[model samples]
Target: MQDIPELENCRLCEWQCGVNRLEGELGVCRIGRPKVASAVLHPAPPQSYTIFLSGCNFRCLGCQNWSIAHFPDTNETPRGYVEPECLGEEAYDVVNSREGKFLGADRIFFSGGSPTPSLPYVEQVVREARKIGDIKVNYDTNGFLTVDSLKRVIEFTDSITFDIKAYHDDVHRALTGAPVEPVLRNARYLAENAREKLWEFRILLIPKISVGEIKPLVDYISGIDPTLPLNFLAFRPNFVLENYKGASKELMEKAVRMAKEGGLENVDWSGRVGLPGRLSEKTSDKYENKGGEIAGGIAKEAGCVTHPRNCVACELEHECPIKNYRPAKKSI
Candidate 1:
């Protein structure tokens, strides 16, 4: 952990707990040392060697990579910490391999439950990789990072895939146990200030859950820059929302249409569509906000005790039921 000094009094993200992760004081992320959940030569757009980092700041209800995100809280084990130098060399070698070229690989992609928790470690890895040879790097984020963190991310990353869960604060909190303000702030900062490094903005369409958010979110992004790339991903239920209905193909098409009509010039959609499940009963009264009542209801059913779902402020954050939850169903 000495290689990444930020762990001493980490403020890498908005929580700013100031805990010494190096000496075992845990913050909201609960990650002591950076660890690699897994690494793969992915075939997705901007194909490259994708490194899945362990742990996350957000306890999202619909996380597809819960096994990696929830980490030690869950039964799944990760490929623990590797020296940044070694991992960097491996990333460079693999991305330049013949198999990589055949698959159109051209960069090293940092993805996780959210990469902000491991920002310092990621910088070390990139530094070591560049010593071997210049390598393009892409960062996939939920956009909950602080202004300083966002600036650091923009400094090293060649591209960024940003996720916007909801436009409304209540809905964002209900869905991810965090406020939407910081995410929105970071999104606007990237679009207005560092547009060149941005790859695209990704919004997951979760049947009825995210539909109401689409129009408002679209308007917000188009307001920043109508030409910024945006992609609506069809949701396949996982994590606490494992039993919820997945987004249908028709829903995704509708989202694209809505974005286009809302004035986004570069709108698109992706991901597997129409996996089976039933929408849970809405418990709007559980939350004060009406925007994400259904999502709030689902979180309530899954044992999230906090109203409005502020993880950073919740007294039960360390022993979060949502973090410990093991869903019986996984649509993906």
Candidate 2:
């Protein structure tokens, strides 16, 4: 592991809050140095195997991981503070568990409030994870990263899930307190360089606010490359924005149609409205009782399910994680 300064202060993202992360220096994201809420080799609600990181750059008022992303102090006490080497060891152990052994996931996802903000540490983790296993690292980001930093980590990542909060600059700024230019630039760069690496562009469709915004964004993405997979996310009110209503079924459909109309192909409407996955179900009785267990079981089963249709027809499949399913047992 590269031994650099102890991140006495970090300015990795747009926030540029040069506070010493190691010394528990609180920044806008409300995090003190390498604070990780939880790290486990679990099947994500989206049905994909993932490793989650904590901390962020922007302060979206409606952040789902408010505890981890917005207020890092509210949760469990911070544990052994170490460098990226420690994270790598932890990740290896998680991914190699009995369940991880079954999935044999080549992909290691870097997810968080805004992973870009912690590029230094994240890159360290990715470098270490790669050495331990033949893994294709992926970044789940808000696309607010600096181009320089983005380029640095791009080498370590095989693919990226870039979030375009809104197409319209004003709306984007309003929703994320940031402009859309950086996101657009990063998306274009990634598409140009990693076109064949499964660059899934996602946009959260919020009620009323995202209707007009969808068309322009879709049009922009279509211009980028019609084959680029566009995922229209169904916004849910989970954390700080509990009072805000979720995107209605109608609105989500309209957004999907708009993407198609904008000339984008390979669009996946399975996020919520079209196909119901463990993460997408809002109030189904089946989901209420079995969603958590099913999600857990699927992850544990690893390499046991195949075919996207199974996920599509399962009544709980929203964004199947295994790409084109390989093979595995049914959820226990």
Give candidate 1 regions above 4 Å deviation: 1-3, 286-291
Point to the candidate with the largest lDDT.
1
Q: Put down candidate 2 lDDT per residue, 5-118, tens digits, no spaces.
A: 636666666555677766666555545555455665555423224655566665443456555554353443434344677777667666666777676554567776666656
Q: Residue 314 in candidate 2 has what lDDT?
A: 34
lDDT (tens digit, per residue) of candidate 1 on 154-232: 9999999999999888889899988899999999999999999999999988877787899999999999999999999
Residue 298 miss distance in model 1 (angstroms): 1.2
Question: Which consecutive 10 residues in model 1 have the weakest lDDT in total?
Answer: 282-291
TM-score, one value per model = 0.97, 0.73
- Give the per-residue Cα lDDT of candidate 1 at 203: 96
